[model samples]
Target: MPASTPVAHSKTAALARVLDAIPKGYCRYTQGNVSASKAESLARKFHLRYGIGCTPAQRVTRRKRGMANALLVMYWPEGCQQVEWLMLATDGQGMDGEKLLDIADKPGMAWLGYELVRRPDRGRTAWTWRRPASEMAEHYALIAEFGNKHHTNSLGSLLQRLANQPGFHGVREQSKRLFEEARRRGHAGDLPHLFYVQKVSHGEWLRLG
Candidate 1:
């Protein structure tokens, strides 16, 4: 399939086809909108290698659970920008959150601005999408725009509210632009991936059925 193709079909199917088109034994992951079923389905579709454990449901980071929908990973050697898109199918907020912060501590994953709602029994941070400021309006504009205010540090919030996706909010696109520029200047800071939820019918995404 062409890079510019809209991929209007199921993301899992489309990603499977794309993976098959690549070299054998390639690794991949999915997050947010890209459910576990999608990841497993696509992995099996291409017969590529996948992880060996299930410590965290869907292989998503434990810190980002509930905060994210899902994550996909496709690792390739450096100097392959086109592969960036394929790898994007499984995004990670810098495997090293502290390191990512050392690099870009803008918002979203870092300084989340929201509220806390719950009794002593149990409670968690909460954040909603915002319009976003110029400091945070670039590649994300293609998906959604923050409302100028956001708050949440929960895993679900990170994935559903923070990670990049169509109609999503709270991403600093300018930071993304900078991320891209860094990559262009031989400074690819971190791997960028797509995110999605499980309700979209990913279908047994975590297993190689």
Candidate 2:
């Protein structure tokens, strides 16, 4: 969970460029290898909090999904950085401990490491994982119902106007009402709750889950 660690050598220009290309608040880069045990321990720090109507197994499954996606960016001596390992589990990424150790054993290979990190921003605009298929279907059904109810104002026209307006105050108010309606209809689940009303296209403002 450490965002950074001190290393004696300065970052090479290539490494700096790689770091710049990576989006902020996603991962942190360091100049050394981390033990598997250490990486797992770091991954353990992320826990899924239980919520109303959520089961313990669901929480565990989601946590495992997140940990499996935690990638380690490795820079080999060949001057290339690639996702060489998963922080917690290796099965999905086609990597294992022995393979990593063998690569480290090679001589004259420079290595840089990067691991996923938690973001401090709590903004609603942040990207999120998609919801379950059943839940998404409910949202789409609701959208269709709303379109039928408000035939005078086409959904595409409303979305286009929202796109033109800064912050889209009018559409945002509509989104808030729809979210409340979804919750009332038991469409929104308790865990992994939907927060943002994202704009997927000029003609659509939807929670893309």
Candidate 3:
């Protein structure tokens, strides 16, 4: 399916589709807007990958119960790529956006390419978080190490440290520009969240909350 296409006919269906699409064993279903039977019915009618009925609330709870080495998906209609959306989703789900951002910011996951995508079918207008799993195998060791280092798992804190590292100034500048643009576009919040940052051989790239 096209990345932008809505996977289901309704918001509940859309959420269920996402829950099913997540790699098996990583999540379990809980009731939300859609009942268990309804979720299963929609999944079957839509031929979704997983026929689990779950809500964003349930998904958040399940995520917290497991390890912190997973991607977070946020849905918003305003089309903001700023940290505000991350924070809002985290607050709604009862998970920590900073921690999830830390996992996504790892050097090994850089290839996953953090970006916001618009999903029109789900709600006429909505954006979903995306990190393609194209190179997960190559970064398994680094990701595992990251999982082991729970003490250093805050994206904001990590970014502060990276700011002191050589050659990270440009990255910080770019992030500032993005934040400013988001603010100008009315997407700014009281505090910002760090989303993803990558340091390649040539330069660094960053996405802020």
Candidate 4:
């Protein structure tokens, strides 16, 4: 049969067979030629869609220190340069001692760029991850007022306790003081946003919101 045969086997069936042959627990198993081929195909697809370049190198190096090189295809607007997009994609550990941000600020590149950020590391603590400490304080006050007024409980006390989790003990911590302030000046409405900005877990705050 010719390589382009459409008689006995359909393209969908052939693709399904390939997928089915992929062993269970792939993460534990080492990636083989199958993975590299797939990576190259993805690279080509990304090139076509995003007007970026793809390397035919077919050398998808796997897991350098438990983190693999992810092949990402990005589609930016018209006039976006391919090299600029590549630089943005290859950031941090993939960085090759070059100044990425400075390169991005150059004339042709800056026009084609926007900020890129990774998802917040889930392992970080609330206090550590909270943006703008003052905003967090305001949110603390809001949650506290809501709990005291409607729920007849002050989340401020709970959050205050969390802030002093390792250092302070008992209700004598700063959480108690925060609650006192929230109770003294009352607040309410839109509990989720308050929780999003502070010590409360998104899951719990989302339910209450």
Instruction: Give the alpha-carbon lDDT of every model.
Output: 0.30, 0.31, 0.31, 0.29
- What tens-digit string does per-residue lDDT give for candidate 3 at 160-201? 443332222233444454344333433323425443323222
Quote the lDDT for 22 in model 4.
24
* TM-scores, all models, native as reference: 0.22, 0.19, 0.17, 0.21
How would you encode candidate 1's per-residue C-alpha lDDT over 1-209 as one tens digit per residue? 11112221343333333323223222223222234335334444432332222234444553364221222333222233222213222223333221112111233321112111112223642222333354244433323322122212222233333334432222233334534533443431333453432333222223433
**Model 2 CA deviation exceeding 4 Å by range:** 1-88, 91-131, 151-154, 157-209
Clash pairs, model 3 backbone: 82-209, 83-209
lDDT of 2 by residue, 112-187 (tens): 3221122334663321122233544554565566555654244444334423322223323444554555444444
Which whole-number lDDT from 0 to 100 does residue 16 have in model 3? 32
- For model 1 the local lDDT of residue 181 reads 39
lDDT value, residue 59 of candidate 2: 32
lDDT of 4 by residue, 1-209 (tens): 11111110222222222222222111111111123324334345443432123222321232233322222212222332221112122222433332333322322121111211112237641111112345446756576566666653455444543454322122123344554555555533222111212222111000100
Count of clashing residue pairs in every prediction: 46, 0, 2, 1
